[model samples]
Target: MLARLATLCPAPILQRVDRLIEPLRATCSTKVKAGSVKQEFEKQDELKRSAMRAVAALLPIPEVGKSPIMANFTSQIRSNPELAGLFKRIKKDSASAPSTDSVELS
Candidate 1:
């Protein structure tokens, strides 16, 4: 009778379930609050922009069309409305520069 009862009720599977529940009990007891994840992201981005300031002004931004270049570009465009000079500068720097493709794409 004992041999028949042991076969009907498995001990090993029940012991394995207890092992799974032990770790889960810790997770169930503690409650974590979600806070401003965006603030964390903006803080990181601010760090990145400020980090670039460490380099000297002579660094030329490596490419064009970015803020460093656009600030230069807008000033030039504003001075001369012809746009020929701007187009030439765009072609020269587009490879490393940010998207100067808006003109060509259209």
Candidate 2:
């Protein structure tokens, strides 16, 4: 639903939503314990990856009118190798997938 909301919202509202989603990374990291299992850590990483993908879709490819909030997020993705790989994978996946303005709720 958050992803859907991002799709429908205008730039200003999307900036607010971007702010809300940005902290997910920190929360995912701080919630983990020193003794936590590897699987638990992987789960949090996956959650962050999913959120990044959703936000990445909102930024322009050439970034002509990019919002500063989103541009900052984009720079973070670029600097992190693991996140960069995931971000690139989504862009490749999206290019091969069919484009549609409508959402499939299922």
User: For every candidate structure, what is the RMSD over all alpha carbons to the true structure, in angstroms?
Assistant: 27.6, 6.4
Q: Cα miss at 97, model 1 (Å)?
A: 20
lDDT of 2 at 41: 87
Which run of 10 residues does model 1 get worst, by summed lDDT? 51-60
Query: Model-by-model lDDT, in order?
Result: 0.34, 0.56
lDDT of each residue in 8-95, candidate 2, tens digit only:
7555555464465457446423456779999988887778767655655454323312556555555666777767777666666776
TM-score of 1: 0.21
- Clashes per model (N, Cα, C within 3 A): 0, 0
Off by over 4 Å in 2: 25-34, 60-65, 98-106
Model 1 misplaced stretches (Cα beyond 4 Å):
1-36, 56-106
- Model 2: what TM-score? 0.62
Clashing pairs in 2: none
